[model samples]
Target: MKKIFLALLLGSPLLNFAQNKLSGVVTDSVNKPLKGVSVFLPDIHKSAVTDETGAYVLQNLPSGTVKIAFSFVGYDTDNRSIPINPGENVLDIQLQPSEFKMDEVVVSTVFNKLQSQNVMKVDHANVRQLQHKGAVTLIDGVATMPGVSQISTGTSIGKPVIRGLSGNRVLVYSQGVRLENQQFGDEHGLGLNDSGVESVEVIKGPASLLYGSDALGGVLYFNPEKFAPAQTVMADFGQKVFSNTSGSNTTLGLKTSTENLKFLVRGNYTTHSDYAVPDGDRVTNTRYNEQDFKTGIGFSNANYSGVLRYNFNALNLGIPENGISEQTHSKTPDYPRQRVYNHLLSLNNSVFLGNSKLDLDLGYIANTRSEFEETATPNLKMQLNTVNYDAKFHLPKFGRWESIVGIQGMHQSNTNKAEEFLIPDAATDDFGIFGTANYEWKSDVLQAGLRYDNRRISSEAHGIAGVEGSFKSMARSFDSFNASVGYKKNLGKPVTIRLNVASGFRAPNLAELASNGVHEGTNRYEIGDPDLKTEQNLQTDLNLEYKNDHFEFFVNGFYNFVNHYIYTAPTAAQIDDHDVLRYVQDDAALYGGEAGLHIHPHPLDWLHYETSFEMVNGKRKDGDYLPLIPANNWNNTLRAEFSLKNFTDGYASLNVSHTFGQPHVGAFETESGGYTLVNLGFGGNVKLGKAAFNVSLNGNNILGETYIAHLSRLKTDGIPNIGRNIILGVHFNL
Candidate 1:
């Protein structure tokens, strides 16, 4: 009896392991085997490619219900859920030809669902697409999206503006963790490198229920590049060059994977001289250089998966003061420059238990910034350190309902390392808990969530108590409850509508609550309001989409109402030879929308035409326009795709963009004139003997338009944007 019991226990392990196996074959509509098809399991971070026989296999998969995705170029993707028992399972997929954009699974949202199945509308774009558009920087690519813009200081420093909001209202995430890099100042840019990044997902509305504070506007989530397939090794190299800035970018990467372990590493270097204007003169002190490195390691078993990632970035950026003056193309930056460094580390883990799963993510970030004015020593320096954590438990599915409960928190500290201080030393702590659920019935879906958050901040006094630049020791606590609800319905086979209502809140930052010194970036003396109230907003969004064989159309509209909207205004006062500005609050409203359409003629399947328009308006209750509002813009593009004798995926495109004049100016602001620009692009993949490579050429502002953007920070200094730039890029697989 004892021997039988022991044998039963030991044999049970082998039986369960045998059941955790999945194999599949992929075929096209004509029953022809399809090679190079991607079979991925996102939950476990496992992927495989179909062989010439269209056969693929994955071993040691978690038991119970799991989701699988099968995808290929020029074909419709298949996403389905399957159940596994104590035996091998096989799933064969048949794909159909598709002319429209392929559907992708989004991870930024609460539930990992395909774009076509999500209750809320989310925009997704890959890095490769942005590169093809001739984007010189990461933010440049992001700004090209509808309803998005950038506040630019030069070609190298830019801050993303979503809809009509900027600064702390927007949240950024990378490597499944929140990015904390002292983003309270307008001079601060997104401290991220484009290399090693796979794609970006934009949530256009309030997302406080998913993120805690500082998400009153929206979220930008970046997905990292995936590891190589099981038992495979891969390497790649790429280079890009720019004419206007005399810039170059170089990148190299290597990756390898086994059945249960994966490792990858990447390095990038970029350098650029001062950017030139239409007059062919370079902007003084605008040169910059950067170095970045990223690495990751991942391991998985039948019931658990874990991944660890690290990134390091260093930058030296010259602060542009005077307009175009120098004609030299030197790579070294002049004085009055900035030095910044960022280090990020994150770990993500998932445990599958029965029919439920638990996910935990932890992250740490350290950021250091320094500014130089006249001497070799730094004039202003600060260091920020942050640690954050998140945990979620996915409840077992019941009928058509799925739910999740999660908790998130962060601890941060800031210290001054220079003699001059703009804000006092501070420490902040945050905590939040939330619950969300999703329900699906036929073609209708509903999603809702509620969350509660609390933040506590404490600061130490600095300088003389009664001095003009003095600060008093203080402590403050802010608390709020937020919620979101969204619904999606299919009106017909080719039409869909979605509506969402969400509320978000933001706790004032240390700079907004304690600043009492000169802001060199803005050339103004700023004072903070210690008694400021928390800013809260409620937003409503509506979307309508229509698609068929040869046409696609989409329109989105939103209205946002805020209580205690904060802004800075000049006062009838001056200090230290600079005008004085004080932070204030008032009730405000903003309304805007984006609409676009795509057409592919029936017989001319290789030809495509696209157009889009975006606009936004913001006003206070006292009938005054808000500052930094973007101008209305329209964009049109014509593109053609073909395959040459030795080249594949050959394409050419022409784009025209028009910006309308901004007559509605805020107090103490000037209006901007309208402008138009033209751009051209072409690219192709070439096969030479046994080697394959991709080549692209792009020309931006081909007409040399000499105009300033409405959101350009240099507009106050009468500096026009860059013009007549050409880009050449090449990539090779080794």
Candidate 2:
């Protein structure tokens, strides 16, 4: 975190060229000069390759303590923490030859540390690779990662599920700000698309200390593309087509940057017809249309730097029922559609102090969502607006310790304007203060944090003289304390271990405290408890990893216990032709783990083989299984990488996934059968005149297997997921 802030401070008083300019010499273990070694500073995306003389120079680096990584092919990577002063820094580095792989730099940690340096586990995915797999949506692509899944209504409506948790339990961040789109609803989707996003990072466990409430499950961080490198301008355009849905997607983007100023803008439009099922039947009213626009502007100079960004999105989603319409390839969506528009704005600023720095982020979001069951008129409409901010102070470094003190808060309001009211207009306020510390010594790293929060919720009352009304005047307040500690240490040259313990709490949401009617999506009569207590949880995690050049293996496990767990179950009653269910509290436990390995085998550097498995089990204190739990799953991949003379780097892969049947069933919950899906994909870059183009073709569900997923919201409707589909895509930058 300190490095990120210092990098922005530019030429602040704390920086002096004579002290900050760094020059280094590289050599092999035996003191022989090593040419072409990569010297990189991940925080600012600065890098240089050693010259023939085994020397590298990084000029005008910000004044602060930063981590530098040295990498080269067929050699062990080396890293060091160096204090950047206000004057010239001359240092020499030496590398060792070994059959070891280099670790990636992770920015989601805020400190910009390498994967091997963090105590917590963060799963990362490359959006470009996902696109190569022919995924239709961002969630669809990321679900392929271990310990992650998606709850889908159709091809267009999907929500990210982390360790069997979705909905409000998971928090989504984009444009460097927390996204607030009506997430409490079961059918709500991630309002924003993957526009301008370069990569994604998933935290598989509770992260309430960094984000606030709603992060009790985990955090999904989407990092946008960095500005076109200094003194460069670029434009990119691409198109994609999906076979099953007869869909077409078009996108265009442009970016430019000077030594001190940078700007970017992008726009995308997509249209898809009803998707076909394995039985050749098309799901009616499942077609959708979308439009997304994003832009950013940034400035940096001597004392500080800041970036401001804005995003706008519009979507037309169809509401599916029991009818299956004839397959159609029309771009116009059918009736009974939902029209949603979202607007997001954010600003991030940083300033450098003598030996430390400060980082601040502010954001505002407005989401207007409306649903029309039939006709052109909307039957239900809701608007949500939120404002939030975060500020952190990086303390001066002391020996091997680094610390940060911060405060976070948000204000929100929700209103309804429609013929029917599912919830009352509400207002909410929240505030939290916390501090965290990190230390690195020898081959071990330690991290910990504590936070205290206060929340207040209230809503206007709707009363009827005699007939009926929605909610009564209400107000509720909750306070909680949270903490986490973690440690990571290297066991040997090729082995590493990590242990972590964290406590998290969630205040009851408005729906869990005030709902008093039927939820059409789930076909259930719902009721809320005003006296429900806050949900509290504690989790312990352990991870072990071993890696060497061509082979890698890792095992990650966790046990979580939750008090006052909130859930809804049937009371053996019916109302308005719907089942009756009430939100209840119980003590529960959830435990699971993930293990994986990747191997290239000796003398087969271009050929790779990988296998991974993930499982989770949840039960109440009374020994009842939880609803919507995912089944055990495993995946394997066989890939090959090759090169074409003066053309590009080419690769191809076969991916297979098998899900085991789930027999653990809760009251009134149906069991699901296991299934398997296989996919094939290949892609590569090509030289087209003076430009480089990416071309790929992928087949999803190539075998056309018909089966239902355990977590699909449409499973109860007897609707099978998408069938065999082929996708083709091409893109180029000019």
Candidate 3:
């Protein structure tokens, strides 16, 4: 018996040691499994490919300290080195999406998708993704992200909305400075172009804790890369030709980084013509054209960085008809109509102070926009000039906590025709102070913040020019406190969970509550009320993720409850032959969810797929679906890649997206119909003597089908949908 017991004990130890292994699953943004993904120790030749379920298993992985590298086509590579004892280990990784614009071989989505199990999420994107077919504006790119959408007034003008929030409920920043545009106006330009951005970060849900009052919905942060000579200079020029619209873009970039100094400067130009429909028809109510320029300089040292930038953009629209009859469809000669010009100057500085940092920003902006209809009287023009300043401090590691505190001040003045009804002639001054602190212990993170804002709005409505309208001044003051907590763990399995909730508030701006007149561009009569109050909201989010060697999936959900949510309410009255609407707020609630999956079929290295879905629903206290909310959407992608030993690399991918119809309030339309679009892409990168080139061709709407989104103002017209498009582009790194 003693001899048998000794043999059993010896065998048990060996069995336990043999069961230990290192394993993980890999996926892309859409949650699709990747195959032919190379996992290896470069110092050694141990490697493997993902199985059919997008899973990979390394058998007999030697126990010890080593690094593992992950590389796949169209995705960024990741390397993690760790020491493993004799035991089973699992690590799941989600790879960032690649861009088709700047660097074909670039890994990472247009927006930088960060890796965090926390409920608070931030994302970024570049111009290529923002300019997808039928995308006529910058906000369009943001629509592809989770918990985000665009409020469409016209193709060229769309506003970003986050979790059923927009307007004053949201804030925007460029290079860490407030964007001083007249954002209160629906037709106001985003006053930004994709050309000058090195990257864009979108903070979803209420970040009012970090930003101030306007961040109730979220904040958009833009950062431009500084020019320096790590490399002499590189240039990117692209031209896109759609069935109906044609666009041309050119960019020149320079970068230099040495021992003590780094400089980066870049400039861009773009122009586009009116778009057409699949049936050879032009939805000519509004034709678009634009020109933009930007210049930036930055200096950096071991402990500090400073940057200065200037940008200008102009937009002109031509009308094809004097007016459209509600029923008959006809084309008219192109007529000169409206134009907008904008310019901005910005400066920013930051310095490290041991465990804390100090940053400062200053900016100035000038804008002029004009509209013309009849040749009888002079055209109406609106002009604005604004300046902004901000100072902030961020402290690192104070025990288990960190803090960010800041103060901001802004002043704006507007000039316009006394009779310009839609555009308010006003002067505004604003001031705010905000602070946020974060605490972490073990697996839990807690965040808290507060902000106070004082604003004054004055208009020359009754002043005498001989006698102008009169001077009317409006002032608003408000404060908000926000807090959230998050927890994460590995639970001895692949399942992960995260939850967070926050409180936020938004102050009403002058335009949403004071403007009164015609907005011919969108064919709606608008009016505002001086009795409007600030809006307040509570938001929460939950997420769950699972991963293994062959499959990966994630689910996310959000809820928003708001008081005094402002929207335009339709009235029974009609003025100047147009329906009238008034801005008003109501108690409302919203809920939505998003999910993604990646599956790799291990039978072969050539085939793989991914799928994602987003859905949202909202209601007023009375149970009516909210207006301007996008319907549920689903997107899927499939790809096949082929590799030849030491020589050729190639791949083909197909993507399809579907959007369901949605209901709206107080409009000639109530709902938009569902539609699906498909895209086909093919190409790969090639290596040549320390240099490489990435090239691809995409055919969008391969079926040549025509369909219009219900959100399209064009739906009111019987105009057919925009036709299919094809794009061929290349990226080279030398």
Candidate 4:
């Protein structure tokens, strides 16, 4: 035994010499550090976790060609193969976010299996994309995606509708957890930050297989950066000033990693006064401010990995309105509202089970909102808390098919209190089981999935005795099923084709189906219908894409059939003799298509120009056109980049877009004028030894025009749109 032990110790050096140490950092689209990222080798059976600084170090790595996999709980999983040389191997990796769970992929279950191009993976917006554009909200960054449209300002209050579906039918995931705010309200902000987002992905069709309820439209996913592996510390800071709103913003980020653990932390703060029209006239009290924070940590080894993360954000809004009495002046703060805070905490683990992969995630989310009105003295408050857990297994092999199975469960509770309960306290439990399978060849692929969801809800005052304290609790149950199949083929030429057919469904929100009261925030009376059934949607889409060296284009068309659609319909009866609108259910049909073309005429590296256009039209099955949908739109952009010696990288860009507004009848038959906006930006970067300093100047609505976008909700309160704005920003990296 002693001789065997000595021989093992002596031969360990040979094993160590056969392995290589690899270390590096990962960042977001904004170049901010990320943490709690998972890095592993499937063929070699080795893995490591990133530290808080978005850094990872894998020891005992075999040399020669090896396959490496990278994944974060909230983001997409990425794989690549590289040849390891002698001594040390250093590589820096940047990971993007994902919409579907990994278990949804067949390749995840089979080792040494090759993935087809048809594996509808999530797409990420990289640094090149964000640095090339200036946006006001998250919608501005993702609205251009295939099958995605914004019906509101397309800025601050925008929500993405997938394949003619919107509102509560869609689910939004941040860092791998659902955000439970007033998602049913159009004016509700998504409460996210573009500064910290590594990237975003939109899942186009039915996703009930993994997400359970409230995913009929699809999912919007955001992933932050992971920790670095190099025992080194990095910091970045920047400030931006907007010309239109005279608004200023700032962000600070930091990352660091040690031998065993890693950490990444970032914070952002922004404040803006009322913006002006292109005419330089103040747009009154349409001012808002926001704050956001995020942090993550991870620990990992060969067989097991664990991660933890935390996030918090808040939005404060002040809207302008014309007052009836002298005491309430035009700038007297007609609308003072606050979505005080949204908080999230998460923990995840992945354990290797022979050839199978076992993963689990547990999370908790808290959302709080409050409103104070000038017309009423009391303050209204609503709070929601949710607990979620998920577990899944990736099966090794099944003939020529790969498969996965998973279980998910969530518990939610909400409470609202005020002078009168507009929305009352409610409790709900949701559980689901799902599976997916995929088969593929070199250029042809086929995939299918199915999901079953069950929900139980309990609410007070439903079929109860009285309105006062005599309320009795009522319990109800709901179930929904989702199924989808997709086919794809890639010709050796420059064109690729994909066709998909899917069915999705959404149950009415607890508040929309059971609440009966008055909301003080918007001064509106709301009534619910208990007889409403689950809303169902059937969608079919075809996509043709062409790609080459200098030009790429895509054309996609879709048709949708919906049942029991929910909408805010006008009612002849008044609450206190004041005109109002109530929630109602009706059948509807929607059809539309979005297409884009890109051309780079100049072959020279110094100059390049790109142009694209998008158009959409939709009408209800009843022939009542849907309200708030935008008309045809198009944008043209031109840019030039110059490399000066070895020290400077300079670029200048200009953009112009036209938006047409067709007539739509809202609660009051409101009509908006069509408008056009132009934007211009110029910037350059200089390398200072190992550090860099970058500066940019941008102008929005350069014409200073006074046209309101089709999505502006300001028409409801008699406020005119703002004009052109300017911004100056500076960036530093080390």
- Please report the candidate that would top lDDT against the real structure: 1
lDDT of 3 by residue, 1-734 (tens): 23532342233322322333667888877788776676654222235567666777654443544447676756656765455556687877787753211111111211111244233545556555445323445676666666677765334666777766666677878755667666766555576777657556666677665555677777877665434323234444434444345544555555554322345555555454444556554455545666777766554432344566778888766543432322212222144456778887776665545445567677888877776666524376777888888778866546766677788777888887525545457777777787766666655555556667666666655443222223344544544455544445444466767676777777677667565666555566777777787778788877777765456788888888888888777898887787888888888888887898877666664676778888877788766667666677898888777865433567788888887766554335566677898878776666666766655666777776677665554556554455666656555543
lDDT: which is higher, 2 or 4? Answer: 2
Candidate 2: clashing pairs of residues: 1-111, 18-87, 18-88, 19-86, 19-87, 19-88, 20-87
Error of 1 at 320 (Å): 0.5
Residue 580 of model 2: what lDDT? 74
RMSD of 2: 3.9
Q: Each prediction's TM-score against the native?
A: 0.97, 0.92, 0.77, 0.82
What would the per-residue lDDT of candidate 4 be over residues 144-255, giving only the tens digit for each residue? 5545666553124567766556788878887666777767664566777766676666666566666777877677866555466446577888888876666777889887
Give the per-residue lDDT of model 1 (tens digit) for 1-734.
Answer: 23532342233332433337889889999989999999988877889999999999988888777778888888878887777655588899999888877788888987888888898889999988888899999989988899888888888888888888888989999999999988888778899999999999999878999998998989999999999989999999999999999999999999999887889999999999999889887888889999999999887766777778899999999888866776678888788888999999888777778689888888889999888887779888999999999999999999999999999999999999998786788999999999999999999999999999999999999999756668998799999999999999999989999999999999998888988988767768888988888999999999999988899999999999989999888899888788989999999999999999999999999999999999999998888999888899999999999999889999999999999999887865789999999999999999999989999999999999999998887888888899899999999988
The whole-model C-alpha lDDT of candidate 1 against the native structure comes to 0.89
- Cand. 3 TM to true fold: 0.77
The lDDT ranking, best first, is 1, 2, 4, 3
What's model 1's TM-score?
0.97
In Å, residue 34's CA in model 1 sits off its true spot by: 1.7
Task: Judge candidate 4 against the unseen true structure and give its global Cα lDDT, from 0 to 1.
Answer: 0.65
* lDDT of candidate 2 at residue 621, scale 0 to 100: 91
Clashes of 4: 30
Q: How would the candidate models be sorted by TM-score, starting from the highest? A: 1, 2, 4, 3
